[model samples]
Target chain A: MSSTEAQVKEKKRGRAFSHFKSLVMMQLKDKLDLSFLTSTKQLIAKVVFFVLRIAAIIVAAYYIFYYSAFFSIFAIIAWVPPIVMALAFSIIFILSVLSCMVGLMKTLFFADDNRVLVTMPVTGNMVFFSKLVVYYLFELMRSYTFTFPLFIAYGMVSHLSVGMYFWMAFVLIFVSALPVAIGALLAIPAMFVYQFLKKYEPVKVTLFVLVVGAVIALIVELIMLIPENINFINDWPLKYRPSVISFIESAKTYILPLYAITEMLIGTYENLTFTLKPSNALVFLYVLVTIAVVLGIVYLIAKPLFLKMTAQPFEFEKKEFIKAKENRKRRKYKSILRKEFLLNLRSSISYSFLAVYIAVPILILLLNKIYAAMSTNILGNYMIYAFNLLIILLILLSSNGIVSTMYSMEGRAGYMKKTKPLDMTFPLLCKIFYNSLFSLISIIVSIGIFGAFNSSSIGVGGLIMLALTVLFFHIGHMVWSAERDIMNPQNEQYATTGGEINNPNSNFMTVMAFLVSFAVAFFSFILFNESGVNPITACLKLMIIAMAFAAMRIYLFIIKVRLYYREKM
Target chain B: MRKSVVLTICVIYILSIVLVGYLGIKLAIFDPILYVQSIELIDDPYSDSYKISHPPRYPDQDFVVKEYSKGLKFRLYCKVMPENATNKEVEFIVNMPDNAVGKLQITSDGEVSVLSDDFDILYAKVYILSKDGQKARSRDFTVQINNFKNPT
Candidate 1:
């Protein structure tokens, strides 16, 4: 080619690279920056949350090492390292897919900056490519956290060489690329499905519930299929134990990328030499080729669809209906609650979250089936020990998040709550009541299912006590979040600026929920096992503790509501 | 400044509550009484088999049985946590065939003397009771003694 032509081509390439870099940096800044804080409270909240997140990571790493030690003993006996790696790879794959699916949806359709970006001079492919890069990095972080500790444990136990460590690190850097690419392939279709469901109100919840239930069940099955648990299948009455052997075989046959990754890791680590085994080299080639092809395909397919889907606003069409005379006489609180209910139902995102909320029971039922299949009477009791906490975490996520966002979702319309003659707490209470009702019913159903199908020794009294405990905690969580929202209405303040949905306090709620659930479950299980107390008596004591906590939270909620009225808007 | 004071107080209160709850959990779950730390079979000189401290409440795996010549004595050596060793009560329960293959005796310590040379093989359980009585004879460990004329 001519020199001028080559120069021009290089210039074009440079320009494109700069565009992509700028876009990615902007997206990352928008998502990661905590500089919007003006108050001491917000800054402190940010610092506290950061510390908590780091603490969670450390705890997770510690457990990974601890568990890996036990598994490594099996490895020494039966060459279990490869099998463990395979299972870990599968988990990482699923986690990457789920997280990337959610993250892509937020970045593509739900992000506030998308409208302005689409109208810019840059091509749609460039924007999509840059966003994909950000998502790839995020998935890489997740994958590293999961795989690194296990890798270290395996290395320590197996006496792996320095060469193996360097090779493993090299492989780890590129491992997440394939899963992120696979996730991108699913993101567009998922968006279409959700959009279609958004149009159909009546069937949406049912379909969404089935989808979430299936996803959760699949994850649970994957977890159980690990090689360490494969022995349980030996005594299983069923012909198939859903063995890890079969899972690995299927992964090699179907999900070739995961198989390739696992093969490479095992092959490279099994020897002290720097040289890769022939099998590892072949699979490594497969990994590289598959990632390239998948990325190419995803980029081509998503390029046009990304712009079209993102440019079109996510609209949940408001239905206008004449008010019926018969419904006009409903009590004010009931009317307000009914209105809040319909409002949430009208938002597709909100409704989708509701489906996940409802799916908690279905997941519990699935877990119960698995537990019943594999567990002895003793292990069955252990499942019951953590059962109440699992339900409460589900409630916290499903109910509290939606309830807390009730007022903030009003946007410019929040002035009505301030201006309306109705008692401020009246609307807040209605929302909380509506949220608590949904969760309370869910808790009751879950308790019944656990008692009947789980083969748990928690008994009827334990079940009732659990139900009451979870119900009170759910109410407390909802009230606490509602009071926070009323005191600090956020989304409406930033409505004109067109940023993302601003629910800063929700993260705190989630962190609190996790801590509380972990503490409750861990301690109660230990107490029931170690202390000579009867299981029912122990459960009752735990219930009383939970009730006291809820009572304290409610007192604060009432005080906050009273104070909210005293202050002027 | 007033708002910051209230916020700080709230943060402190929440932290204190969490700390107290953690301690309460520790109090309830913490095991006061010490238990068996390890067990081994000393019958076979060629092979050494040992199981490190079984779970406090659950004995999931069968104890490894070591076989020896018919004339050899079957001995089990168990090590318990040395804490409060004086007050601890250890019991040894043996179940043999109706033909009564072996004579068994357990010392105040956790050592088991099985005279399996009288007949064939034998099985026994080691139960340890805590001094506090908070822990009863909950988890009983198992042992099997096999009399093989040939040790491979």
Candidate 2:
């Protein structure tokens, strides 16, 4: 071979190696970016934050476990709903986090970047692998945040071994990612159904039928529990033995991956005398089938659907009269609010995410009722109190997307508002009001449902407590908005600018909001008791307080809006 | 379309109220309680004997016997407490029913003794004496049972 030809070949090889290295580096960098530890400072801060959080959780767990007898009595009287609720919430937490990841992935993968990526020298496999790696890392970080403390608490209380801890860590990672994988795989078919439904009005009727069918099924299950024939299942021991054992076996086999990890950690076969059994083989089968199905669907269906969704142009059908009217005033504030609401409501991902959130609490409530009915004891007021707390937390969390998107949703259209003839205060108030209204409605609906089922137990006082809590929360959210300077609109058109900027004061604002809201609620309770007022009267007082706070928030919002409007974009 | 959606929601709200009312009425009308009467205790060489009976006022109440002889076991009478009694507190008055002739031993606040001949109380623990003079039979009539030996 000629020396020139050899040199050209060597250069080509060198170019190929460099390309591979760059690809690997890009993948690693993307993975790191998605993690909580994006930088040295972030890593240090997160570690410190997590250490403090974990220590607090450990202390709490120690107290609960060491003083188990007292809590046990409460647990017994309350029908163990809190423990069940904790478990349920953990499941929902996992699912919700995964849904968010899926939403993020869908947003990123389906965006205009796909057009550029498709024409790159990169193979389709390479692109999918890169996305998957990033998604997996994202899920891992999220799961760690939510579940690490829980596992640590569990281990400390249970006195689990080092092997057990390792297994737990493995199971947690896999189980957390399982939901996202499953949801994404399922979305392919869901999307197809959605497309089919989009063509016809019968989709609404079909959904109604499905909901009715579900309710009917629930009613049937409730009826079955009350039947004389089924009473033996709760009563007879000898007859129930096989069924109970088999049910546990089935749970270990098919449900949560934790079962397999637990068996492995505990050394199931070694504890045969204690009635501990091994079902790892069965679990492996279950996991295998699940992975196979998910991967197959992703490869065969998801890729095609994703491509189709991206390839298709978004068709906007506008009513001519409405469009003309909208153009006449060019009320940018109204337009922004409209866009935000529509985006949330129209997006399939958001709707599904909301559905999961709503369904989970309702399911937990129903399950609790069933358990309480079957047992000798009744669920108590404290259980209801905790449920209210959970509902409030959920409401707060759900508002995150809305609040985070508030400034970003403005796009370039917000620039017009700054240059408009109208005062900036008007537009800002309108934006805050729109968000507040949505938040208020959700809170009201959730509280109303809780009130309906638990009216006799929760009483008018509970309703008042909820109302007051909601009111304070709304004001607090607005305060957060102002203090965080979340109103300075950012254009999200460029990918690089999408990263969240750390405002050190955001933490201080969060703490202040929590402390202030909690103090007010606690003080109200004390006053209600000190005055010897009846619950209804106390509730009335709370409602008055809530109204006062709401009024104050409105005034503050007006002032902030004017100030923000005067500031440059 | 928006107006119709709003109207539909209003209609659903009205229906929910009516439905809840109807269900409440139905539950009140069909109030069901399990029935329990007198408990019979059989005397055996292997086991002791005891009996518990309720007045006819609680006709619908039933008792299901659960014997945990080795641990905490007692004859549980599963009737609802009186309406006036707070759920947090229970006050019981025990009396010896007719037909049984024996000096009953009474225990209150962990203090045990035979019922005083001078005082006749509605609530007392009845204890039957054995031939050997060692205490053999006892029943806690007024006290909540923490643990008991099953004589089934």
Candidate 3:
């Protein structure tokens, strides 16, 4: 009733709106920064990249929609078209939630900018609200980046009505919100869990292993869904087909969100005419209602939590102060190696990448089992063996890429290496040894698993020969990789920015990972199949070459790298 | 031009194009896809919808043991829509069970061969593809194993 009270309220609203606009613009500047696109060549490159990406999306969508491959594959699983739509939507929803959770947590609480933004002359709620809007805009943009091209491509491939395009846009906008809301609700808990993990190292490692294991289990389950008997193809288990179809059909009507969207978009338009079904209106209403309720809940719980977290994120972090160990007499190199390991352990990037590396053996084993289960007509025994080695070597080599950035990651601390009267070779060995040791573990585990279960033909003696060959070759590769880093170190970029800015080392390593994996496979295929040599004999020959290569690389690396080390110092 | 120093590539043609002044590149964007106006996989090509054989034994359930000798072969046929769609080619392959000692062969052109007399009924699938050359097409089909001499 009071005009002055109302004016104050209006002023606050105006200020909040201004802050929201500025915050969103700030994020857009961060993400879609085009300052790098200064060149005519760069413009051409961007245009070409855009064109190619569009072409890829069109090609993929066309294949999945207009082409028979998509249909027949679905038929193989006894799934109809509607079910495919349902599954696709569900997968997108899940991914959106996951990304939203991670992004929200990082931006809201963990980001360095959180301190600056929260301290600004605005309500914490205003800051939180703007972040969510910008986040939602980004999430929507991301969804469209993945999907909108396909929409256009599908329409171009097939004549879709303007109504259909409009309907898709409508559904995409609302459906996207549901996931963001879900992600926000999950974010605080996830951050708490993250803090818990940061406090406990073993727990973090174990959780990551468990996550990878869960992925393996899911893959196994999906693979197993392919029935063993061809007779079971039509009515798998012969009896359940009707009941399964009926259940899906019924679920399409009643299943809350997935079915509502599915029924509205896919199954409704039989004649390809976008006639507004009464049910479509109802589904639209349901979608709006669902988003409203979920977002309302997110506001109720997450908003307060965000404000609290903005004020004091430390509340969640249960810091365990480990007592410093008494300085004991240890070898200098040992201390160097231990320090290197500890540095990598603390880094979130290094920690996660290491976790992936650790799980490589299981992934290789499980993947190889899938390959084994397939009864290919043309591929022979040697092809399988070669592929198995390729997987092992490929993963090890790619992960070992971090070794190239090892010295560069030292940043300002690297100055100590230059100044201290220490043997440069000692530090170089420290960097090379730890990751090589990691690769060695992964390689042996993979080979051991392969030797144990993959094939009986490769006896223990044969396996030892193969293992020795790979081990020697890997040592050569790691040293060569380290030498490459010393030759072109980006010490300042990494030290100052602390981000994974593009580097030649990673780019070259990725190319080599594929190249080396394939070359070894190609050569083995030739040696074993073309020459008609037994697998054991092939291993023996490879071992000798690998040993020789390792010798030359190590000898050359030691002599050459010391000079570069001195120059840098 | 302030940032011209940052551009690594100093190509004459590109620079000339930039001078010729910001004319939009006219690409067809036919970038129109590989799409069909309407594509539906007719699972059972014959009879209104899918119907099992008389007495209705599913491969997952019971099988009708219509006796037939080894080396029996039959051609499985299925049609895709437009009735005149050019590349309606499909591949039929039988999935072998874990305990399957007997093997069946299905050809690229949808010919099913019963190689062993050890097994009863085998389930098969068809992969229909577009070998339109520019792009490829395929249709996959699983069929009822019809033996030439099976006495019903």
TM-score of each: 0.56, 0.49, 0.70
Q: Candidates' lDDT values, in order?
A: 0.61, 0.47, 0.62
Clashes of 1: 0
CAPRI docking class of candidate 3: incorrect
Question: Which order, best to worst by lDDT?
Answer: 3, 1, 2
lDDT of 1 by residue, B1-152 (tens): 12332344345334433333333222224344354343222232111434433444555743635454433333344333442233334444555456665665555443455554654556666554443444434345566556654232
Over B45-141, each residue of candidate 2 has an lDDT whose tens digit, in order, gives 1113223443366444321222222222222222222211112111222355564332333322122233323222223333222222222333333
Which residue ranges in model 2 land beyond 4 Å of their true spot? Answer: A1-25, A34-115, A118-120, A129-267, A271-412, A418-425, A435-512, A533-553, A556-569, B1-152
lDDT of 1: 0.61
Interface Cα root-mean-square deviation for all models: 16.9, 15.5, 23.1
| Total residue pair clashes for candidate 2 | 9
Model 2 lDDT tens row, A1-569: 99999999999878765654565566567445546656888788888987887678667755665454233222211112123223433465557645744553554345555555546676555555445545566667665764555555554554555665566566666655565666666555555565466556588668867986697578647644543223332243334533543454444444345444334323242210111234654664566577567767776766765566555654553323533444455466676567556755564435433543444345434433432342211223333333344335333433333444445445555456566566666555555554456556656665665676556654866675766666565655564554244454344442235444443333344444445445554555454444442455555666667667667756776676667656645
Highest TM-score: give the candidate number: 3
Worst 10 residues of 1 chain B by lDDT: B38-47
